[model samples]
Target: MARSRWLPDQHGAWAMLTVPFLAGTFLAPHPGPAHAVLLAAWSAGYVALFHGQQWLRLRLRRASRRPAAARCHVRPGLVFAAVFLVLGIPLAVRHPWLLLAAAACGPFVAVNTLYARVNRERALPNGLAAVVPACGMLPVAGRLGGAGLPWAPAAACLLYFWGTVPYVKTMIRERRSAGYRRASAAYHAVAIVAATLLSPWLALPFAGYLARAVALPGRGVKVPVVGAVEIAGSAALLLTLLLVF
Candidate 1:
């Protein structure tokens, strides 16, 4: 939690904390203490999950061969998990429905664990696995904030990131392949078109996304520059969603 210039690797973490939690809270007619506590619990749980996963990774690498930092994460990871569990107990007592989110996360954690064991963290199955828990947070946010489950915003969040995975893959993981770049551009283009047809307001940020994906990927833009643009796009999305919905 150094909170230096935002790490590119933590995009999913930030998205999970921001989009659903803020949108759901904003959409609520009257948010109160329970919503606050639940959000805190959820955020802490995500921290725990992140560290715990890191610890697992280090442990696995240690088994294969001794590595520096292998022992460092275990205590911190467990501390976060303990804190998360403690926070959850009372929140669950206050809102029984929180159990449902817990149950949903079980399968997600399972999937993540399976992928991690195979060292397939960047694989499609792993990416989809990451997105599901973020989707689950939307409903939790809605429930805690005294709103009905927010399916529309949740779906919007899902579609936005679902498109993001392949687009990013083309930029970083599969940057060498012209074919993959074309495929990513086309996917973004289709997303923009579909979003426009569905709702022009909704498509505003996706239009920006399509532009960047098409224009910037093959060019030699730096990583931080790409991150800055993505941050702007995310701000555009947050603003658009706030104003329209």
Candidate 2:
């Protein structure tokens, strides 16, 4: 079966990835009404921009296949505008960050969508994925009257990176598997363990890593000093988390 480029795939994956970061940002100590508004606006705007690009790409691809130009849907833009209006109104009243976040959504979604479209063969870039959450953490930390780039968010990003390496390997191997139930179970288990050792919500790294493990199989991929690296990384992550929290 041919994949529906506009419906799901890389774009969808990136969208889902944002959830944990959003949760972490929101869960941080009182972010105030302004931050909340900013977060919501940012999320909504991201969805709109992503969907718009998908629609445009789908149309362009179709047009290339036909003798005549293809007609594209106008509804996407209209819907996005409506959504932005509804979500942006409240934020405009009190918090400017909300509008700033919303504004950021257009660029973020554009960059990710373009990358996914261009880099179909390769796995999503971890460094790129890390950027969003890091940015999200900034406003959130600031709202709490702390430095935006504090140790906590940095540790969280590092943990996310560590877990993601294994998870990406898994995802590549099991791309067509429908055994999400098993994957989800394993993910939750790792998340629980990490959270216990780290922070309750810090489990995102574990969950993200688990997803990569499911996607890419690493059963035989060997590293010369894997054990040492794991031990060192884990120790560092723990120490950082301990110091931050």
Query: How would you encode candidate 1's per-residue C-alpha lDDT over 1-245 as one tens digit per residue?
Result: 44431122576457656776777777777777777777777776777676666657767766567564555555556776787788889988877878877897899888887776666778877887788787668667777777888776777676677777776777777777788789778878887776665567888788778888888777777767766776777677767766776
Q: List the residue pairs that clash in candidate 1.
A: none
Question: How much lDDT does candidate 2 score?
Answer: 0.47
How accurate locally is residue 101 in candidate 1, as Cα lDDT from 0 to 100?
78
Q: Which candidate is the best by TM-score?
A: 1
| Model 2 regions more than 4 Å off | 1-28, 31-39, 64-73, 98-107, 116-123, 126-138, 141-151, 154-166, 173-244
Mind giving the per-residue lDDT tens digits that candidate 2 earns over 182-243?
55347546554755464664564455444434433434444423333334434444344434
Query: Among all windows of ten consecutive residues in candidate 2, which has the lowest summed lDDT?
Result: 1-10
CA lDDT of every candidate? 0.72, 0.47
Count of clashes in candidate 2: 17
TM-score of every candidate: 0.88, 0.50
Decoy 1 TM-score against native: 0.88
